[model samples]
Target: MSFKSRTLLFVICLFVVSNKLVATPKVKTIPIFNIQVDSLIEQQSIRNDMTQLELLVLYNDALKEKKPADSVNIFKKLAILNADLGQPEDALIYTEKYIKNTLDFSILNSEAYNVIRGSEAHKELSENYMLQIDWISFIFLYVALIGFFFTVIINFSKKANRCAKLFISGFVGVHSLFILEFVLYISNIQYRLPHTYLIAALTALLYGPFLYLYFKSVTYNFKFRTIDLLHFLPTLILIVYLFPMYSLSSNDKIEIMLEINNSYNINRYVIFISKVVSLFIYAILIGKFHYSRRKEEDSIKGKKPVNRWKKTIYAIHVIYLVSYIIYGLPVSGLMLSFPYFINYIQVSIMSVMVIYLAYMAYVQPEIFKSYSVGTSENTIPPLEKYQKSGLTNALSEELKGNLIRLFVEDKVFKENNINLEELSKRLNTTRHNTSQIINEHFNINFFELINKFRIQEAIRILKEDIHGSLNIIDIAYEVGYNNKVTFNKAFKKETSLTPSEFINMQIKKGLYK
Candidate 1:
């Protein structure tokens, strides 16, 4: 064959083989990325290293190619990823998007809208994405609204003092920002630049001091030093640099995000050093607190109150450490586009510490005193005087005062002939009223009070050297009790034993030693 004939024949053979080997693209199906991206939810199907994100990438590619089998997994993964990163409101939006995709897919299954919708998977498989936004919105609205009101009520409490009030204000502040972000997204009036690391950096920087303050509050009785505010210096500068002119467009936003990420590059290294330093500081504090508290506790006779705040402080400290560690990973460098949930969790922990500190500082100053064992007695005085009054709680003040005065101050039990009627008459009241007062106010009958005082008189007699030889009956009669039986019963009831048993037990226990 000539050169032209041979070349043409080779080309024809190659084209024929290509046609035979390549199967026709099967009947079009929904692309995985479209399903995953649109699926947009937290589902059982995709997890583990957030592998679902990979599926989402695939889904988006498939959708771009107009692949058909409906899937909403991408949005689901994003939602979960956002939540894992500690952005619930962001997660909520992603979930809503996933739901919308499901709700729009098919309405054949009424179960999707039902209250008892089975597993989350069932709901996705059955519905389209459209109906979900409203449902999710309502639920998110309900949660966000409740969170808002609780925030407001917490903010308004009278006992919540100025610093605490500020903390509560910030407590509501973060959630409010979340609400604003959600509202803006839902309204589509604004947009957050995707994969922007600046937000993550700003979050860490902005909340670091707040976190530190929170740490100080629960962990230490914190008094702010000038340096405490300095932790936020990076964020403050970042914010000031955020002139509207600088952020005039998305490019500006991206530029800012890039800058912020770069700052994290700088500060995270510092944060690492700071964390290492913090760990050492924490170790020192632990050792000091342990040593100091142990010495203090030994001076008193009780187990020390654990430096309970240390646990909370340690948690934040660990978070600081973790943030530094995360910054070290290559994935972390890329993923700084969004702060991890750990970042947000650290922020929340800090906020809680702040709120807790505020409570300790202002809302409940008693917390400050709580660490003081000496002050505990002053917090709630014993009711001994009231207990000794002997008048019923139900008695009128005048009657009670008179009763306590006549019976207690004057040692009326010394009069063997003292009777309830006589005492009632002296107080200018009926016997029944006096009886009721004694029963209610003193938690004892009148006779019981008299017997108690008589027992005390016997104790006085026994203490005197001359009366040591007196038998139970002799002691009883001398103390104004008519019979030994009455004295024994009264003695046992008052001192948990008979007179003979009390003296003998006390002697055996070495009180007499």
Candidate 2:
């Protein structure tokens, strides 16, 4: 046989063998669910380090086992994980599945909501979705909270009423926790501090009582009593009730969180409602107190009194009431939808309130100062009788001369702690008569009269210090003001310029050497 013909025959034989081998069926291997694989997947999920593929596999396994609750939770976690991993489309699909399988709307406060609201996929689907919250709101809220924190800190450091400082500190503590939760929610962080919820709740419960005390401190003579500690009993009881949960392990805490989030807990709802009721009651009490005080002042003085400071505080209380209502409606089931817009409104109001508070702290430091009239009765004969008496004119002139000498020559206004009673003592007259003399002769209250002298002294120092040897703070201390903010404000109010501006003007006019 020829070599080429023999080679062709061999090739045909090889092709026939290959066809036979291809026609034969091979055994298939199936993967078994083993303890190692299950353990690894669970560890990943527990650590919140599961990949999308791993989560899907676990989710499918849960579904295969007919574990609906486990499957739903896995799906919810998958949604959040995908969102954090920047897979918004997958996150939305998983979120839809979570909603469909569980029939649960409680995910509105979860990271899933943040993902959906911020996702372009969701935006493309619904342009008119007014329920969406923007990320800017979080930024604004954070800024406002930071401002509140610093304002409280600065106020606490000031020589203000101790009760007022304590109240502001309480507010700072409660709101700081709230802001922490808000940050965690927006960032999709899964970790929580132990007893965070309990601490926040207890602090929230203290808001009304703290506010009431703050008002009392500012509006009247307030002294701390042992009985005042009773206001914290509700918080103490709640702390005790939550002590067991606080001691739970991390896994146990996660389980409890899931249960709380998936369904309404009656106890939690009751506590929330109680908080709203307490705040509302406090608001009414504050309003009543303010109204009665204003009425008394009007009746006694026979004129409209300057209550801008008090009015600002009252407005803040009203804001708190409004915010509680807006927040409580959705939380207590009184409203179907959580009014996300209320967050913006509340933050805006709080920002403005903080700014107003800062302004008051700067411009009217005396508002925070404790002032009290002496016990001397206002029975210094009627004004008509005093005018009819020949001694009235002589007494008025003598009082005026003494006041000028004390304020200008003696520089008594340089005392930061000077008050109406102290000045009356210095003038060697009754507090009522001294106050009357200042009101009638100076055409202003004791507060304004003292500030006028202090501001004048500040101007004199600023004008004389041409070598720039004195800073604004130095001038503030030298002129009976403990804080430069207050001094600058008073200087501007009296001379229409801040201390620096006034100094610059004096320099420009060649008034300084």
Candidate 3:
């Protein structure tokens, strides 16, 4: 055989073997195993559906049974399940129910809640439940309560000028009411108790007028006239304007509160602007009047306390005006950029002012006394009253020198029970002559002269008491004041500083020695 013929025969044999292998058939597998596997999966799905149905029934029963604890637990479970099942909207509903039932802000941070946390509903829900106690509002409330008590006491107290007391009472009372409304507004208590709506707005216009009138009454001893009623015309107009809101039902008011952003209409901005403008204008008026009086009081020696008090009051008013302007400009769209906290600062200024006035009322009741420096047409002048006196100028000068010697060298003003009569005896003069000498020579009343000497001595003693052993009452007693109130009054009159304030100032200045 040739070599090519042998190779061809071997290839044919391999091809025949491949054909035989291709023609051969293997054993067949059964379809029953796949069918059984599918059945098991179906059964598991049925069990899951049945379990979910049972949970739903149980949840409904729990609701019907009024079981809050059980309902909350079920709500959480259902929410998580719904989230895992790709039904996020349902999950959020159940989450809201859980949060509403428990008010549990902590739950929103759960890993399982991540599915719905990105939704806007979750954000709103979190905001609704997350409320921190507003400490500033609480402070305002406390001051308002003090203001109320002060108003009641000053109205009835026999001390001080009745007209001044009335004006101050109105100022404090109106401010207190405003603070209360502010508390409601900021703390969201107004939405719950809807009657508080527009109450602050109604009184907004009263702040400037009341404060202006108070300064007038206290400083100039100006009596209230019927024309003064016109100062409150803006307040009356505000009441009329807000009457619609005030007359709304509680539910309607709550609805308005919910949609508060939409309710800031032109009228609202107008009202807000009016409040700030009116307050600023009145503050300016007060400044002008106060400046003129301050200049006059500066010429006099014994008006230090009242002058200082007025300056402090005016400074506080400026602070409030600045803060309120900052707050109001944004609300009224006058200034574009302003911090949100300025409103709080404005209210806090008022609160601090109330607290300060209350303190002064307690410490220096004499400050509220009718200080009529101007001689009214119906009143007798101090000089005129002394016109018929027989006291000679020579005798007056001698008595004045002796009185000065008694106060300066002997420190006789330390006698707690010392009065004009006792002082006259010390100077070997009559009480009338001593009064004339104090008035003419010192340009102050006998009480004022005594207080000036006593306060000067008190300052000397306080400066020497570097050991800090002397308390206010002790220093007061050492200065010939029968009580701490009188002592505080005397001390503040001369130095325009409270006892503690003077000590602190000295400490700050390193002049404690």
Candidate 4:
């Protein structure tokens, strides 16, 4: 199809899909809704003469009227509405409040309205969702720093001071993301509290380039220049944005706040511009890094595995950048089809990729080893076995423990059941170190850690069940196998039993339950 034709079709799809939202009648909040919904909404407020369902409409009506602080009221109403609504797939999906379960993406997806307690409560939806910045977001805010400080300790202990400082800057950059989220949530025109224009613009200034540096550092071995001070250039510009709000009457402050908010939209234009700039910066680095290695390979003539892993690491970085663009760019509301896109800006998804990159960077440091421009593998020694482990943490104890956890214990990358990442999230430790420490202590690698769980799950299913109505395929998937054929081969190799034999033997032995 032609590009114009494809673009036309996409536009049509957006209209078609959005009709349900735009055209649907605003159902009466109480008459059509039930006592259960009323009870649900009632929890948010003690003054419940009007049913909670009534409040949903009140908030929406208020928002339509541009009622100040109506959104804050809506969020209060939603906190109660959410319980009766069950899972908040559609509601929270568009809402700025990122209350989502990371491990189980499906739990909050595709939820249709189910009725109970009589009146058909018809999804008590929000056209403008509650984007309240509360203590909750601050909790995730520290993630960047937590990852950062640990990187510092890792580098400092290794005595790589330059890399440690670079990492600390990157960590500060990452920290600003939460800061941005917090500022937006608080300053959302919907709530209209005393608008902290100072906080809003200054935090935004701090966030953008920090993110740019973080990505560049991981992608290229680019050293921070003395001119790297330019990243803080925007925060310095915020003095102008804050000047208009001072010494205003409450009414005057509202006018000033509106001007600030309007100006903020212009500020959004700045973000889109920065986003494009950041994208170009990343691409240039990716290109420079890619061909430089190819040239080096031509000069030296080494077997490719040494360089091959490095290439894979670069490829993953591209995938991550693409995924970020997929979710992050659209969430900016710049594109025409923005709302139609599936948002994957969840911290968990990003965390998965970040964890993977860190793992690959550590496991295969040739990618990160920072050769001179145009230099190649022809000159450098193949990454040593110890070198692979050492890149993550060079000490023998660190290497042994990491390999054990990565290969033998299988925690971080496990697809199903218990895992290192899951355990870390449960325990709240950084993922890189979990692998590093586990690898150091146990002397296993990541794959072994995960596959062991898969193999064990398969065995338990066979031994514990007598009435095995589900087949080998079922057991394999139940244990998180992507396919049964692989599971059967692994099961046979590991436990001396093909799945069918294992199930049959279990039946004869009466072990199935």
**Top-TM-score structure, candidate number:** 3
Candidate order by lDDT, highest to lowest? 3, 2, 1, 4
Q: What tens digits encode model 3's per-residue C-alpha lDDT throughout 289-404?
A: 88877655543654557678878878987888787777777766766867767777878888988899889888877666555545333121256578889988788778878888
Score each candidate by Cα lDDT. Answer: 0.50, 0.63, 0.72, 0.47
For lDDT, candidate 2 versus 3, the one ahead is 3
Candidate 3 global CA lDDT score: 0.72
TM-score: the better of candidates 2 and 4: 2
State, as a TM-score between 0 and 1, how close model 3 is to the true structure. 0.56
Count of clashing residue pairs in every prediction: 46, 0, 0, 30
| lDDT against true structure, model 4 | 0.47
Any runs in candidate 3 off by more than 4 Å, and if so which? 1-136, 260-266, 298-301, 333-337, 374-513
- Poorest lDDT segment (10 consecutive residues) of candidate 1: 297-306
lDDT of 2 at 6: 100
Query: How many backbone clashes can be found in candidate 4?
Result: 30
Root-mean-square deviation (CA) per prediction: 15.5, 17.0, 15.8, 25.2
Which candidate has the highest lDDT of all? 3
**Greater-lDDT candidate between 1 and 4:** 1
Off by over 4 Å in 1: 1-155, 164-203, 206-208, 211-246, 254-310, 313-324, 327-513
- Tell me the tens digit of each residue's lDDT in model 4 across 279-362: 456556655755555544432323234356546544654554565466555545666545432332344343443444445445
How far is 354's C-alpha from truth in model 3 (Å)? 1.3
